[model samples]
Target: MAERKAFHVAVVGATGAVGQQMLKTLEDRNFPISKLTVLSSARSAGKAVLFNGQEHIVQEATPDSFEGVDIALFSAGGNVSKELAPEAVKRGAIVVDNTSAFRMDENTPLVVPEVNEGDLHLHNGIIANPNCSTIQMVVALQPIFEKYGLNKVIVSTYQAVSGSGTQAVEELYEQTKAIINEESYEPKILPVKSDKKHYQIAFNAIPQIDKFEANGYTFEEMKMINETKKIMHLPELKVAATCVRLPVATGHSESVYFEVEQDGATVADIKALLKDAPGVVLQDDPDNQIYPMPADCVGKNDVFVGRIRQDLDEVKGFHMWVVSDNLLKGAAWNSVQIAESLIKIGLVK
Candidate 1:
């Protein structure tokens, strides 16, 4: 908390989408960094990534690459995190991982600063970033939960193709043009890239985002259901999610239904609570037909909430729309924010 010098920093997936955003976020927030190391897989290694008007070479990540590093932000993938995260920790580097690898690990903290930043102190050199959908949802709902109490949550997500990766975004663009011109296009990356089936994502809505589990819900949907409970520390909270992929290139939108313990809680009360909540921007105005949209929230880090209203059938229920740039608030910004929290809480040395 004092006037400290910049620390040595590393980004594991510097060439990827969220990784690039992480680099930009570090520069934007003026995160203290005495040394910056850009790392990636063998395929992306040796590439040049620009930072602070200087070109930094990307190196293939190995256990030894973490030597002398202070904080490392990882977004490569689950397998990479599973393989290298402990290695990074072994080298004395605190890791803020943007993958699902260690999210459920009891030793690792799954954090969204606004929602559960206090958990960061318990990290044993690794902290997990919540799922993109789960981060925005909890950010919007936690204040309400604290004020009125919460019983259940039902969420339907309109996720963008970028959540899959950069290749999926390119596939969506190529597929859209092919469909518009009446040309042939093959599907290679959508719904699930490694699954047996791939669907056209351009100009089409795919009801599935990840592989199906034994219970018939997609892996992504289950992540929302399970991660929300863990992050909120409410194991008994009833949560259900339906995640779908849309043709959009960025941002994710959700229709969230939640039950409050306070009966007859009006829409105005909900709006008043969120209007001043940290990291939340209220945009509900039916008079002007104003509401949060994915397109409008593409580059912003704040969670946008709107369409607040009481459910017709249940006096204890309310409905709202939440939108956020999945790559930023959901992934990159959230990851960087965790690092910032580490500094604030004196966890980072």
Candidate 2:
């Protein structure tokens, strides 16, 4: 493989939680960088953030801020991406958006690098990263989707509060203390920040993760079901999800039941496939009580899969647990990985 000259890169929402992780991932990966511009909301502009031990000032992100950027990574929010992504594209920047604003767009490629890196070549100036939970799930499932053929999927997520934001993590800590001290506290954020109701996320599991759609699934659940189909390019694939926010702070875990098209696929077959799968760590040791867990997967970029077993009732069905850092593999690392794919495939100059 040959290396190309470093390209100019800009990160939109440089000061937010996921954005900070994106910057760190780019640094840790030693991504080629001729120039780096850190852009943020007006509220966070002018703040100084240390990157690779050097100070970089966050500037307000605007259409004009993308003038010379060859690649723009977006994670601020959907509204922000919806507004500025086109401008970035107009200025010759390839946008890797980490929001729902463009994930379902017919023209945009919804990618999970492990599952759909080839989708990068089809980008019309923008590529969409799948939802956090969806990214880790498909990474674990794609190998199966490829070898045996996937027929159906049912996932129940145990997502961490960090997926909500830094504030939700703060509220969880604050609420925990209030409870331990026998104090009273009102919940202000969790499940969904903008929803009409808020719930305690310290010791409780909130079954609803995002706003409810007319179809009765919360937005988060719909994101999983729909995005899974799109990423796997199996729109007719049957999928369902129930997303829940847990007290844990970083990783997202899922109990997934999937049925394959191939008959008589054994549990050992599934384990063997995942053991060598890309972006997946296999940890299925029941006798030793080894399995993937949120606390253990907090800082890792790889999705962890475990507790593999054949479903008793459904011969074609298998169940497994999948876990990954919502901040890293779920958002930042996935976004950065898409950018790297762009460079690797020569989609970006």
Candidate 3:
């Protein structure tokens, strides 16, 4: 008889938004865990976190936290990941980092599992979860790229406040209620939290996300562009993005314009392709008013794609609307999925 192997898993920044989701996903998926360690910054240490019907206190994450951990899921801020992810690795844990700190690192595999599970074999010690927006976009596009070939992609995102964290989500709810009651409120955390300007995210759409680069694209846009190329291994593919923040709290929606390499591909062909693509959900029925939307995608793990159509003029051009729970499929679910992939492919110890 064969014996089942269970892993010692650690969730870094366990109290944070995506961290909580990571724990939930692990529990929901019934991952094989011999032991689970919940870690957070010193500020969140001693906080109680409910996991798998048990209350676990989050410990202050330190270099020693990874001593016996087989896999560490990190959703902390970039600075936290920068300092501890390597420490976890040095201690023999494979770190699935959900931050930009290592996504562009040549040695770190920027993984989306569905698009580049094979890239997992190339990981040195860290596997990076691509940015939330980048994850969904690539999932919806991978099948298309596989069948028709892809020439260029341009994406405009309608993102949610949860992408910024709990504080932002609370602010959105408070601000909305305040406006309804005609109360004055101050804006503090949108577009870019640390940027010189602040904008209201409730009853508004902030056209910028992250700090703008000298090239005029916001940092979020650059992440989408670069991460797309890296994940799909299409460095020469033309990709552009404009990111915007909306009033929603959990899901992220993207309008993607793409040009396929194949000339005669039809809208039906694209829909047929995505309908069977792994990790993708097709929901496009215009006559029945069925289409992907942020409201309907909350708590779901599949990337919802809809509104597929051919360009008015360009025979090779097509458009799609991609939506997913930014915290789930976009971040937490993908990280866990990679960990699952690692186990299935015999990469994790």
Candidate 4:
């Protein structure tokens, strides 16, 4: 048998929350790595990160960083991805970007592996990972769509604080502590950090995730709406989203309502389809009070689904709950999964 080849891998934003998870996931999955290069912003450049039980120093990311890299997983902010992803691609590295920078680019493919792994073939040297909320939602919906044909989708996400990054998670912790002790704390992050105002995220639900656009839908919501359509290859599919940030720290949960085109599809049929779906777990025993929740889903790579039921009034509509670790499956694992798909399909050497 020919020896399985290992490739040189580069991880951008090695010090951020999602970046750290990416490294851990690569290690946990035992991804074949001939060489590993960790890159971060100048501020975080000199930090030490441990991968595969070996300490590696992070370097500041630049155009030259991708030299000799076979695959690059990008989790830095969108601006950094915008600046460096092309450079990485120019250097012969296949980039799986975990940012909004390239998702809407017609030349790039927005991928959720279970739903559109085939789209990776059309990539122009880069693949875009969908939003954290969108990733889990699509994983749970794909099987049902394949079995019953989808016409419309409406999703309301209950996202965790960690989706906003480590700083927001810290803010939630500090504010919760202060509030419990009868002390005052100021809000500095949540519901979009760069926006004109910040809101409390501890013990409260913020209806906004990213800044609102002219259409009044937050960028996060628009991402779910548009990305869903693109991944499903349903350009005219009706999709709407309402994204909300909650105090939970790791997982993202969504209440998804979708209308299937085929008539007479029962709740039992959807459950059976999702039960056999790849990268999905079915936990829909409502009699025992079982359902997917953020706290229980932390650190897992699979999307957990539950609470499946048919809409009372709409014969074609069905609802289900979907949850997954935002950092893992949402960002890091998805990026790594893309790379794996690339190797599996012979897109990367």
For 1-349, candidate 3 gives per-residue lDDT tens digits of 8676899999998999999999999999999999999999999999999999999999999999999999999998999999999999999999999989999999999999899999999998899999999999999999999988999999989999999998889889998999999998788877677899888888999988889899999889999999999999999999999999999999999999999998789999999999999999999999999999999999999999999999998999999999999999989999999999999999996
All candidates: TM-score:
0.98, 0.98, 0.99, 0.99
**Residue range 1-349, candidate 2, lDDT tens digits:** 8656798899988888899899999999999999999998888899998788999999999999999999999999999999999999999999999989999999999998889888887889999988999999999999998889999999999999988888888899999999999999899988788888888788898899879999999999999999999999999999999998899989999999999999879999999999999999999999999999999997789999999999999999999999999999999999999988888887888
lDDT per residue for candidate 1 within 159-197, as digits (tens), equals 999999999999999999999999999999897889998
Backbone collisions counted per model: 0, 0, 0, 0
Worst 10 residues of 3 by lDDT: 184-193
lDDT of candidate model 3 versus the reference: 0.94
Badly placed stretches (over 4 Å) of model 3 are none
Worst 10 residues of 2 by lDDT: 1-10
Error of 2 at 239 (Å): 0.2
Instruction: Quote the lDDT for 20 in model 3.
Output: 93
What does the lDDT read for residue 154 in candidate 2?
96
